[model samples]
Target: MTPDRHRLHDHLLDPSGGLVYHLRALRHRHGRWAPFHRVLAGWLAGWQPGRRELVIVGPSAGYGLPTGFLARFGRVTALEPDPLARWLLARRPDAGRLGFDRLDCLAGTDGLARLAAAHPQAAILFSNVLGQLPAPGGDWRPLLARHLAGHAWASYHDVISTTTAPKPDCAGLGVSDDGSLEAVLARFWPGGTLPLTDHDTFRLGGERPRRYAVWQIARRRWHLVEWADNTGAAPHG
Candidate 1:
């Protein structure tokens, strides 16, 4: 990362980052949130697929790239926790090659179970939303395990700062925290690990620094299953 990029990341990860992101999301005045989306999309690019079903939880301003790109390959079921954001997605013009679905925020284990059932065989993308959950009791592993069923793939992004520690081992799956998605995936899935191939980065346009770490992940098992070919309504662009 360049000095500029690092600076940007620092600001975004700052405690006040939520305020900054929320303000930009509220305004939609410019591409204030575009950099974050771009970096996330870059990470998804690594998991190239002929076709696959995807589930994106916490769809904020828009379905970020790579997820947008994956829409071309298969269907996408987007779950947004914020009502305002969901309303915006519902109103936005279909960009073609992409589909959108709005779900009530997954508040607890039951909610996660329902979400997992709704999009079986889909790759689940959870980005930046985990930290917002009430900590200590927030057990996402059940949700992850539910989605990981049927040879599915799931990608999660969590900000690493001076605080917060890596999660403990789960089900023999290794966990590693690097600023890169490749390193995370390798830690999650070893041996037949694919190369770290896709990435994108974005920097805040202003003087204040902010950065985002994006990642794309896929499970080898999912490749063996058949995927649906049709995606839902395309947003009119």
Candidate 2:
């Protein structure tokens, strides 16, 4: 699966700029939020923290992560093909440890190899990025499988409604009857049930906050050794 060469990507290549949010800030508190950042931290907490290699995919704008979360790794590498986002990331503090590489996994499998080659152990953090990277015929299992074959992998993204856009009042992201993930997981694990778990349902903006309360749902932790232990989406509307 390479980068989506469609019109959306064309908008990302231009050397423009934008602010990158911490991502965790979106959790619904009194009313609105999608605290993906907090959810990811909790899931990752189950595993070893201090390690050597951690690769971040599609780090748009920079705040895809911070030196604090990455303190465990000796060095962190980010694969972002968008010059606009990369340019913004360069200005971030601790930029030295956060190496930059315009790796377009959307282009092909080579980029995946480059990431997998990380020494010791390599974990992938698809922090709010993958869903945007057009999947081949709308399937993301292959990529997840490959990454899982290496080290622990995690993904956080917007769970768009298959039928229509989200409503204004819906605050939490629960597992609907939509076999959104099951269908994809089946492609790799065959009869395996997708390891999904519910994340925090928080209200952002305090009381009478900005938007609806958002719920974070993600996969259970799994890494590569024991068939792998591993691991969205909203762009603030």
Candidate 3:
């Protein structure tokens, strides 16, 4: 998959910006990203699907993901389009634990459907990708709800972000899933004086329980991350 045609973006950055993101992740994986990674790992541990096969969409180098989590599946497929990221992911610690498969899910409208058709028993995951999608064509929540209806699925993506948003209280490990984005933001960034840009991911989760966390993706930019799992749910029409 070519960079412009099918490569994924690195949230507000172009497809080529993935390299920069990878560098930043390597620099901050144990420093700035420590708190968020801890919370993410805990959240991942909570996801227990019955299927042995798994599909991870847009996981760039598996930086924020724990290797132990990926090893839980008997078979793991990474539906990534970035060539560089695919290479880096293969070298991650204990990469040998997973039986990997690669595909470009962003290549066409039916990519997701086709994946489901090909691996009907596999559980699907959107790994911090939904929020980074370019507007107009980036809205895949509806398609996901429609196409992967019968399968177990989970995702954690940006709900909103701003260069002025304050740092989150990562003193804890659990996410607060009590209210709307406004309420959650108020709890996370109380006394915020600047307006926030909604990532349009708020419409997801569809009344299901959602967990919220704060991520300082950059020194000045902060993202309110949201996670949800739709397991054992009926197919959407």
Q: What are the runs in model 2 whose C-alpha is more than 4 Å off?
A: 1-36, 44-50, 64-67, 109-111, 118-120, 161-237
Candidate 1: the clashing residue pairs are 8-209, 8-210, 8-211, 9-210, 9-211, 93-235, 93-236, 94-235, 94-236, 95-235
Which candidate gets the maximum TM-score versus the true structure? 3
Worst window of 10 by summed lDDT in candidate 1: 220-229
**Per-model lDDT:** 0.40, 0.42, 0.73
In candidate 1, what are the lDDT values of residues 115-232, reduced to their tens digit? 5556655556554455445422355444444433443343433432211112233221222232343344434344453433221211101121222332221111111000111222
Q: Each model's TM-score?
A: 0.48, 0.52, 0.84
Supply the global lDDT for candidate 3: 0.73
Better of 1 and 3 by lDDT: 3
With candidate 3 superimposed using the best TM-score fit, by how many Å does residue 59's alpha carbon deviate from the native?
0.7
- Residue 110 error for model 3, in Å? 3.1
CA deviation > 4 Å runs, candidate 1: 1-22, 25-37, 49-51, 66-70, 90-105, 161-237
Candidates ranked, most accurate by lDDT first: 3, 2, 1
Q: Tens-digit lDDT track for model 2 on 7-78?
A: 124234322212223222232222233343333344446445334667777766544253356566677877
Least lDDT summed over 10 consecutive residues: which range in candidate 3? 8-17
